[model samples]
Target chain A: MTEGVALLTVFVLAVFVGFEVVSKVSSTLHTPLMSGANAIHGVILVGAVIVAGTADEAGVLVVALIAVVLATLNLVGGFVVTDRMLEMFGARRPEAAAKDGAE
Target chain B: MIAVWAQVCYVVAAVCFILALKGLSSPKTARRGNLVGAFGALLAVVVTFIAYDIDNLGWILLAVAFGAVGGAMGARRVAMTAMPQLVALFNGVGGGAAALVALLELSEPARAGITRPAGFGDDGWFAYSPLAESGGHTESEILRMVDLLSTGTLTATAFTVLIGAVSFSGSTVTFLKLQELMTGRPITFPGGPIVFGAVLVAAVGLGLWAVATGSVTLAIILALVGLLAGVLLVLPVGGADVPIVISLLNAFTGLAVAAGGYVLENALLLVAGTLVGASGTILTRAMAHAMGRSVSSILFGAFKGGSTAGGGEASDRPVRSAGPDDVAIMLAYARKVIVVPGYGLAVAQAQHTIRELVDLLEKRGVEVGYAIHPVAGRMPGHMNVLLAEANIPYEQLLEMDTANGQLRTADVALVVGANDVVNPAARTSPGSPIYGMPILDADHAGAIVFLKRSMRPGFAGIENELLFDPKTTLLFGDAKASLTALVSALKSL
Candidate 1:
């Protein structure tokens, strides 16, 4: 239970740190940023791993295996999609042919 | 010694995740930030494998293999327009995983006949340590295991399961709407608000019951009730409002992950999950604000589309319609043009064709730029991704406030399949649902050319007051075909 107190402290600090980190993301990149954040929550895949591989009963293992599969999908899909979207923003804008040409 | 190594790896992973988000604040470092997060994810999995005790590895390995293949295939196959839908589905998957992990943790003991301690899971509630020893006879160990089941842990299990259930089903509804497999129109029932209110209360009651009784059955029932509540949450939000709903549900998945971390007593999970939860919440509020609404209003407003006969009002409104040649002449001679992209553009799959038109206009010495509303398309930043895929420069994509200010000076504002953001009703007509929402000042352009399938109201189901302005000329037909025709017309001249 002493570890629970430590976990609580870590959780509380993360709440503030996390918000501060992403508060200034440009509106254009919001979707990819969100998808990136989605991948981060896949950290729970670790819990799924332990439960699926070593739980005493077949039922628990089966359910945990499903959880494992889902977490993997979310984790991998989230990062890949985010990377693909961000890749579009990196194309160097066709030699910067028009710099506020509309003005 | 191995414990120390695993803890160190976990710490590094947490830092990488923090850095990943911090870098995502700008486009310059976003990709690198993502790779860093991936590295962290891979490292976390490796470290866990080292630390986790396993009697069997075949099932876990198979699951990982299955996910990797499915994820890669989906990412490559999905069109840019469907990215939001894919993201929604991923959020649902993560939420489902969290809920299942909590449920399996609770159910394991009943099957194994562990009566006193309740959860004799793989590593038990506490991380297996050297102090645990071979003999499980210590009074303190017994008390600690009992405490894990009896009080605080049971509450966390209930919270995680319910939040996870809501995120899973709520995200699925958002996905369906984005995919157009279900109607994007708000599907509110009679007394919709009151119905949702009752469901919310019932869900809360169920959550408390699960905690009070520590009954797995109650928790499962509570999860089902939560699933119903999720569907109710997103069903009433119209297409224009679905972006915010997706963001809100993304936040819900984050909160559920954090709750799951508590149940597992894992600090890395605690940090990563809380960070995601906080980020999603902040983004959700920002999205809601951009719509000139509160989070609660967006969730419960039902959008309640105006019943004032859409056909009757549109019939009385006088609009000058034009052919491709007339639109081509207007666009060709304009000094500057602002192309406003919307959900319609995505639906028509006209992003590339519109980019071609912009290029033609550019070659003809007409300056071209895009006016991007914050809440454009199906999700936030949707237009930017679509245009970028067509290799449009990031510089030409102007924010709504900036573009609106420049609209007066621009000669032509070519609106392709967009309606709500350009609607003047947002600035006038207090009775309008989108009255206070910010809109692109397309009407201020010297001439306005609108591309549309028909005179249909935008997803908000509100009439575009801009369409009635004398400077606007409505061009009827598919967005891509109209633009392609306009390109040919310009080439002929």
Candidate 2:
């Protein structure tokens, strides 16, 4: 198989496994996990930018550029909003703070 | 040269995802895990940029700048109360983008020439050529006889686009309903079931047509039909089933994106999409179980408005009013206090004040814990998320199973802006609509202090028989103000 095909297969399988694992986790962890995964989606920005700059085809470049913008907005915006939510829940508990300080 | 490093970065990012998932299993380390996962993503992006073979940087830089601006604006403006709506919007955007990717694939010239294989043997699946035999390649006559076929990339792309569009539009509607921008009442037609069936059939027919003809236009039309179907499917579902619909739609979005990733041959996209799809599906099932409803029943919009009897009778029951001093006296000397939170707490935005009250009680050597019912608010796990925002310790936020066990042992059950979830009628009254539905056993507490706006029945439109019980006392007013006054009275005592 070609290198691209190999990469694609690995990614698909990994996603399937990842989904299985995430599904088993307690409901309490859903928001935090999503928040984390969303942040990681920011990587799509770099990929988009790269694809946009390298593609000789103008249409492909335009779409790639657009993807980059959307993905980045999703990434940065999602994190900031989520962090603010965490803060609203109240300042960290004394025990949590103590642990943080120790670390 | 940089491709090697980019590949390494992808590997590292994947590992981070695994670790993050592991960390998210427990609340204690969730934040740290999230941070680690984010860093991994950042590393992957940066590495990809460095390895990119680009001659022109200006346009790419411009796109990046635009994204930065948009991200900053949205992050700064949106409030915590609207976070769920914002999440829905973001999920929609993701699905939309995936659909756009599919659309772009369809526009590719090379894709237009692709056609379904003529036939297949007894296996009933088409086999693509591993090699191009030059001129005069012999076609298998037997293979041509059987019309067994496999859907090609274009057909897959079209399906992805259709499903993604539907998920996007449907999620937007759900978000609007939750934000109160749209009415929460189920929009049902006279022949709702028949309409739903017709739409389902049409959607399937369109899918088949697109596959057989390899027509992008036909696929686009199918997408529109699916989009309409999505709205129709969710419209007749009542407020009670909104949470389940949200979960189910979320799963749909994930699956759609996964299909898009397959069309685009993107590894990261596939992985992320599948993760979201699977998790959302499980959560949907769990939510259905929590509500004592089947997934099929939820889909068919079997449950809509609340029972009629509870609302009128609940308003007629006499409520005993309590002053801050009365509340303070009861709470000040309490050995164990359990706070039951409901939709009113969310409405009053009183989570912060409630957290403060918990702290004050702990300071006075009183044990305070929160009792959270599974479907306490507008969504599943709503109370936990709200309490978490107020920095309530994960341990203090007790689930119904755990909290129910401790209600009888408590000195007082201070119900803050709560209703139906604490109703004893559900367990005792066999004729009641909500009978057999598990609730927090707040009625069993030595004393119950309920702080609500009025003696209104909860979202389920059923009277909480607990309100009329001798053990219960109602403190009427805004939850925030009531809690503030109660806090001061406790301080004075």
Candidate 3:
């Protein structure tokens, strides 16, 4: 009803964009990339918020709130962990170089 | 309808996610790219709270805070060895959340601002009172509501719930397997495939029924069955292959979120979810290829009784055993060395010790590089993280192909706490489980020294034929202890 055709167009285009973006990644970045993408879907938090905001029943509200908690974990935990992993990749470079230089 | 400004904001957030993924692929911009994605996630969350007249604002904020603190703590505190488990757990919760949101949306149909029929929801659906009921409306109004509840949206909702539930349970099982809380070996039952197929067909059938009739009961049943299907899907996969399963489930969760986006009519969710779904699929395929297996074979291989069956018994074949000093002397005199690190190294927490030994080898003018198999530890890129934690230079880490080429000219292949990656069985024996897998050419080296706790076969339970090679020397001990001895032994030299 709400321009389903338009949404379908968006979906189709997004699929191609998705495939194109990550098509050339090296295997070394696979773990962090997976984790980062996992965090991005945590945007489902938006859906949880919208539903929780409108729920008039206690049962629905409780369930929506639980959804919020879980999505928050997925979102926040995913980013933090991914960042932590990338930090290892970033933080050690100079130190490693320094160690090499010292040796 | 979303406001123009909010729509623009969502678009911006979605673009950020794309850039984040692109940046994450390469090493140079990866950290900065993650930060950009985080900023976008923060922006989208803030915009949602502002754009919607959300009730229970205080409670929702509290829940957000509670989850944030817990997630950050867990992410920060987990050991590097358990990174795969943590990722699996976080992925599970995300998937579970998507399913629950879709379920809640199904229960509150009138929130879409349509009048429900009097007997509506009485037929085994969630029997909840409509949130905003308008007085007696015309037949046209009813028809309008029907138009709003298009088959398209309903179908998307059904897809969301089923796939989300599957991703949730599958990720949890993967986490358990990775954490060693459950047996890493494949678990199969009599008529397992038949039951799995039946339940899968039932889930798809129920999903179509839910879409056709808009029955919440059918949807709920579909979710339960989907959860069962997820568990059954991953149960037969052996431990070494669980990472691929996790990647596959990550893709599943992404597609579920994409469907949920369609149901909610949100462009940002649609785009972000689609990106993950697509990218995760490719990533899963790449990981499987790295292990020399197909996705289907990894899942159902145990049932076929081919890939995972092997004797766990330690081989009594006489392998030339050596002391740490002998191995150290071998390493100290070598002109070049390649170290093959694996899950055992991570398990024994010997990465730092190995790094120390590598450094000492380099100081002795012995060229050293780590031959990193794609699925090296529990997950792709796992050993890099572990070795990086130990301050090992990134330059010293070589991809499997590069390491293989170097192995031919190397004097010694010092395999520490690794078995399968260097196992020549992947190449020589067609009947072997890992026959087609691309293994590190450790056997190409002039001499091979293996550090082992025992003669136990690798995670696939397959024996390594290279162990019987006369050029191979076994130094029996814990990886850390053996590495420490080698480090000191080299120092004495």
For all predicted structures, in order, the TM-scores are: 0.92, 0.80, 0.93
Candidate that beats the other on TM-score, 1 or 3, i.e. the better one? 3
Model 3 chain A: weakest 10-residue lDDT segment is A94-103
lDDT of 1 by residue, B1-493 (tens): 1387788899999999999988877889999999999999999988888886655687798998899789878987898888988999999999999999888766643343333333324235344322334243355534433444655677778888998999999999999998889987778779877988899899888877666655678788988998998998889887677878888888888888888878777777778889999998998887777778888877766466563336223456678999999999999999999998887888777777787788898999998889999878877788888877777777899998889877879999999989888888878888877878888989889999999888877777777767888888989999888888998998897
Residue pairs with backbone overlap in model 1: none
Best of the candidates, lDDT: 3
Best by DockQ: 3
Candidate 3 wrong stretches, greater than 4 Å: A93-103, B110-148
Candidate 2 regions exceeding 4 Å error are A1-16, A34-69, A79-103, B1-8, B43-65, B72-77, B110-150, B290-293, B305-314, B359-365, B375-382, B393-395, B429-436
Per-model i-RMS: 3.0, 4.3, 2.2
Docking model 1 quality class: medium
Candidate 1 overall Cα lDDT vs. reference?
A: 0.81
TM-score between candidate 3 and the true structure = 0.93
- The candidate 1 chain B region of ten consecutive residues with least summed lDDT is B113-122
User: DockQ values for all predictions?
Assistant: 0.51, 0.31, 0.63
**Residue pair clashes in candidate 3:** none
